[model samples]
Target chain A: MIRIFKIALRNLLRYKRRTMLTSLLITLGIVLVILFSGLAGSFKAMMIGQITDSSLSQMQIHKKGYVSSIDTMPLNLTLDTNKYQKIEELLSSNTEILAWTPRIKLNAMLSNFTDTTNIRLNAINPEKEILVCPDVGSRMTFDKGREPGTLLNPGEVIIPEKLAKGMNLNIGDPIVLVANNKDGSVNGLNFKVAGVIESILGPQGKEGYMHIKDAQELLRMDEPEVIEIAIRLHNFDRLDKVYAAVSSKLTGFINKKGVPEFEIHTWDELSPFANIAIMIDFMTITMKIIMIAIVLISILNVMMMSVYERIREIGTMSAIGTSPSKIMSLFLAEGLLLGLISAIVGNIIGLGGIFILNIYKISFAFGRQENLLLSPTVNITELLWVSGIVLLIAIFASLQPAYKASRMEPVDALGHV
Target chain B: MALVQIENVSKIYQTGDVEVAALSDINLSIEKSAFVSFVGPSGSGKTTMLNMIGCLDMPTKGKILVDGKQVDTFNRKERAAFRGNVIGFIFQSFNLFPVLTAYENIEYPLVLIKNEPAEKRKDMILDVLDSVGMIDQKNKFPDQLSGGQKQRIAIARALVTQPKLVMADEPTANLDKQSSINVIRLMREMKDKFGTTFIFSTHDPRIMEEAEITHTLVDGKLT
Candidate 1:
């Protein structure tokens, strides 16, 4: 076997130019796969991170009807505070959940005494909200004054830069908020802009940030309460375990009518753009198909040509008592060596691509994001899978021609011109 | 005692319903340690007979025995093993593997047939290289060697396994006169030194004169 391998290697080296050219095609194809994988993987991580960390935590517990009518920011379907506290007790028992925050959602019309615009307002506990989403603090920068920790002594608002710019409002400026409560009464609250922070990506950016106390008072939640819980886990990779823990605790504990009081959702379930994941997978699959075609055609072409040119050598080996299996091994060894070399070299180039991206500092807006930094990642498993597949496919492509050469009659092969 | 026996052997090749007889009713016996030659015109069954004796092809009719083992009875793998162990071949084209150095080509047979150890294989390869006066050219590839040198290495490759018989088909057909004489002379000397039977087919009179016994074939029949 070693002798056959040595001959195979020498045969490949004998056709130096052709070997390099064939290997180059394989290397380039794998490089494309690896680079695309890294970029696509980074997009997934970045997008998921933005949705989970900067806005919604990993999971949410909402009243069943709240999601269906969430666009209008309905207050009627919010979880009852008393019922939620019971679930919260169950959730607190799970060590996987690091932090949790209860929120009051309100839809109100905001005016700066000059112009009015409608907004989705999230009323959150200042202390717990920051712990659930630390990115909020990083995004917080005062256009004029320091943002408050929570509620800012009440009657304070933290608005998106886009909203602040549109309303022509500045820090410390008094604003009026008009609200409609579940009690069929219209009311209004007077408030001052506390700070203007950078917008979060995706739909969360469209919200008007506020304290839970302000929402409770404005919407008259004490009259008829509406509250939902957002939760963060210690390790996001443990999302399934934590989601299941909370879900099991909440499910089967139903009201008299056999209706579950609460519904559980992962961030992916709640976000409308979750289909982006399926799209990324489709893109990777398409890339794989194209890579296989390129590699298969290239290896088949080169190996067939190698067999054609070495017919007499094949005959000589056969005549001198080399077995057909050994002959096949010689040729397949060439194909395998090519694949191994190409895959390894291609991975190096792919990693270099990541390094190049880092050096150039690539940041682009994806969907509603303005400046999303892509940290192109190299998942070793994904890299190995692509390379391994390419190598295997290359051997497959070499199979027919190698078998053909091996099975050739030595008499006829030697007689070949 | 005979080392090779051909018993009423005939080979017929069919191409698209047209049958071509390449060898007909061949009966011959080759004794051990003899220099023998089969002389014939092109397409007169010289190469075909050689192929049969080497167990490279089974006769369509009759039986061929190499060292008393029936060639027709060996399966594909068995035939390959028989060919590897019992018969060696040198060809008209000096068909050395182009990529391998002269030493490596000579060492190849031992690797394939015997799986000989490195030290033993090296010694055997060197012995043949010395016999052919090609020890200094061991590292040169086929393309770098002259035609005579290439055939010398081809002979060395054929002899490396110490087979019962070494079959040569037009071994001197491609060489110049001096190179041809040198290769034939080397084969004869190696046969005498190793006491290995040598049976070659050739039309060259010089090669025919070197053989101790000659069998002539014309139109697929021994004449």
Candidate 2:
């Protein structure tokens, strides 16, 4: 066996130029796959991070059927203070839950004295909201007199940039918000603008922020109520496990009809960007298929040519009593060795390419989100999987040629020119 | 005792619609330790006779017994085993693996067929290399050696396994007169040293004169 391998190695080394060219082609394919995997992986991760940290907060819990009519901001479907107390207890005890914030969602009329428009608002505790959605602060642009990167303060509003621009609002300018409560009564409240926030979805958004106490007062609620609770987990990779655990615990809360009163959703379920993430995964798979095809065709071509050129040699070996199986193994060994060596070189160069990319710190924007820096990274498992695929494809590609060489009749082969 | 017995053996090859006879009713016996040669012109049955005797191919009729075993009855795998354990072969081209050194080429039979231990295989290879008088050229590749040196290595390769018989087809066809004489003498010396039977095919009168017994073939028939 060892002698056969030695011969196989020497044979590959015999045609130095052909071997080097074929190996270079295989190595380049592997390197391209690794680089693409790193870039696509990093891009998908970065975009998910932005969507979750800025607005979605990884996962969310809401009253049953609330998300169906979420666009309507139905105040009648709010989870009252008692229901929230139960949820707060469950969330506090779960080790996976890093932070959670409840918000009062409502739609109301906003007037900048001369101009009036309908606006969607989230009323939150500034301190708690920051823990659940930290990147939300990065979107805020303070108007002159206020502190930068600050969450909404009591009696102050952070209007969307589009709203601010249309209404010509500025910091310290007083505004009125009017809305109809569940009781069919209309009420209004006054506040001053603190800052304008960039919309995470797109520029045409009409969403604004206010302190929770102000929302309760403006809506004439006797006690605190919330339409939704956004949660952040200690590890984002534990999303499914935590989501399942939280869902199981909340399943015990039943309404009069015996159905669960709450629904849970991960960030991907709530964001439109999930489609693009899936598409990135699709593209990565496509790239791997291309890499496999490149390796297959090149190895098959090289092995077939090797057999054709060495027909007389094959005859000599066969006539000297080398078994057909051993002859087959010799050719397979060549391909296996080629793939192994090429994969190693490819991995080294690919990882180095990723390292260089990291050093450059690539930054780009998606939708209304800006300055998203991609740190391309590939894990060991991914590299191993890619290498394993290349090696398997190489063997498969060498099979027909190896078999052909092994089965050739010595008399006929020796007679070949 | 007879090391190889060929009785009324014939070989017919089909080329599309035509059947061509390469050997016909070849009857011969090679004694143990004999130096034998089959001489014929181009398109004669010299090579087909060696092929049938070596178990590289089976005769279309009759029986071929090599070392008292019916080689004509053997399957492909069985024939290979028979060839490996009982017979050795030398080719006109010197047929040394181009990538291997003379030492490695000589070691090929012992390593590939016998799977001999490295320590013992080294002794067997070196012994043949020395008997062929090419021990000094053992480390040189085939291309690095002269025609005589390459043929000497090919003889060494054939004799390394200590088979009962070694068959060479046109063994001196590609060598010069001097190289041809040297290769024939080396084979004779290897046979004398190892007590192995040697049967070679050639049209060269110089190579034919060296064989202790010679059979002439004309157009697939013994003449």
Candidate 3:
């Protein structure tokens, strides 16, 4: 048996061009699969990191029923001071809660002397806001009168970077904000531009933030009626557990309007970009399957030709008393060897390609920002999975050829040309 | 005792819609250590009989006993063991694995059937190569050697297992006169040295003249 295997190995080496062509086809398929899947996974991580770290945490708790009709502010389900304190106390006590930010969000139109833009106004506690948005401090500038780490005062707001550029507003610029108050009256107020924030949300830059109390006074709300609550957990893996617990607790708390309604959403649900990531993932998987199928066909063709070419030799071995199973094993060994060699080579090629892209800092402009697409990133878990998939494909592709070789009749094979 | 016993052995082959009888109701026996040849024209079932005797094929309607054991009753593994321990085969085309060196080709059967240590394997292979006068050509592959040298290596491969019987199908059909005589002479010398039975299926008159016992076949029947 061992002798037959050695002979098969030597025979395969004898036909160097054939073996190399077959191996090259398999290697390209494996490399393509790994490259596409790896990029898809990295893209997903980048999108999630951009969304979760920049704005939304793992989960969010909003005023009851606020999520269903976010277009219309539900003044009846307004979060009261007691409910805010109770929810904050409950979240801070649980070790799973990394941080939570209380927000009173509303839609308003902002106007400078020349330009006006509609934006979502978010009022938050600056100290807790920093925990959820560390980049906020870096985005602020002394050119806006409010320096880095400066505490914000009432009747002042931070505009998004894009909005500031569009309005041509700088430090101490007074902006007028108009919105419908809880009593259904059109109300307007003047506030100073304290800072600017750079965010990954979108090109529109339709967000602005102010002190929590100032937003209530400007909007004419009696108490702190929290509109949105963003919660960050210690680990993203415990998102489901925290969401379930927080939803159950918030269900018992009545809003200022004496209504019992609220909604809990995970980060994935809150971000539209997550769906784009999922679509990228599906495309990557489809590409991998197509690549594997092509490689399988090529490998099968190569192996079948190899077996046919050596029909006489196989018959000779059988005549010398080599069993059918042993002959099958010899062919299978050749297939496995080819697969392993190609896998190792393909990995090196894929990793090398990524490294080259990273070394050159290859990036492209998407919309407005330049983003890196191939960052030479791959987790150990993903590497193992791709390697396993390549090997299995190699083994599976060899089965039919090996079976054909094993079933050859010694007499007929000996007579074969 | 008779080294081989054939009792009404027959073989039928079906090719698509056509049925052909390659061997029909054949009965023959040869004693131990005899030099025998089955001689006939093309399509005379000579090669088919040799194939049956070599355990490469089974008789369709009769019994074959090699060394007093029923050949037809042996299962696949048993047939393999029987072929390894009791029979050797040589082909006219010199069916040596082309990629293997002459020495490796002779050493092939030893490694497969004999569990001898590495040193013993080397000694046995070299001894057979020496007997066939192929020692100087041991490092050369089949393509590098002459037709005669390749056949000598083939002969060595067959005899390396030290089987009781050696079967050759048109062994000299593809060789020149001198190389053919050399191969036939080497086989005769190998038979004398090892006391192994030699069987051949050929139309060559030289092989028939050299055989001590000759059987003639025509149209799938011995006549």
Best by TM-score: 2
Q: What is the C-alpha interface RMSD of model 1?
A: 1.1
Model 2: runs farther than 4 Å from truth? A143-150, A202-206
Clashes of 3: 3
Worst 10 residues of 1 chain A by lDDT: A143-152
Angstrom error at residue B163, model 2: 1.7
- Name the lDDT value of residue A338 in candidate 3: 77
Give the clash total for candidate 1: 0
> How much RMSD separates candidate 2 from the native structure?
2.2
Which ranges of candidate 1 are over 4 A from the true structure?
A111-117, A138-143, A147-153, A160-166, A197-201, A223-226, A240-249, A367-371
Tell me the tens digit of each residue's lDDT in model 2 across A48-104.
Answer: 877788777888899998877877888998889999999999999999899999988
> In Å, what is the interface RMSD of model 3?
1.5
Over A1-417, each residue of candidate 3 has an lDDT whose tens digit, in order, gives: 566667767867888998888778877876777767666666667657556765565677776567767666555556678767877887887888888888777778898957788878778787877776555554455453345476467888888877888789886789999877778887788899887776565311246778888788777886667777777777877788878887787677665787665678888777777678779878987877886686678667777988988899889988888777777887887777777778789888878766665677545554344664646476567666767776777668888998898788888899886
What DockQ do you compute for every candidate structure? 0.74, 0.78, 0.62
True contacts kept of each: 0.73, 0.71, 0.67
Report residue A39 deviation for candidate 2 (angstroms): 1.8
Task: Going through the candidates in order, state the TM-score of chain A alone for each one.
Answer: 0.90, 0.94, 0.85
In model 2, what is the error at residue A301, expressed in angstroms? 0.7
Superposed Cα deviation of residue B189, candidate 2 (Å): 0.9
Q: Candidate 3, chain A: TM-score?
A: 0.85
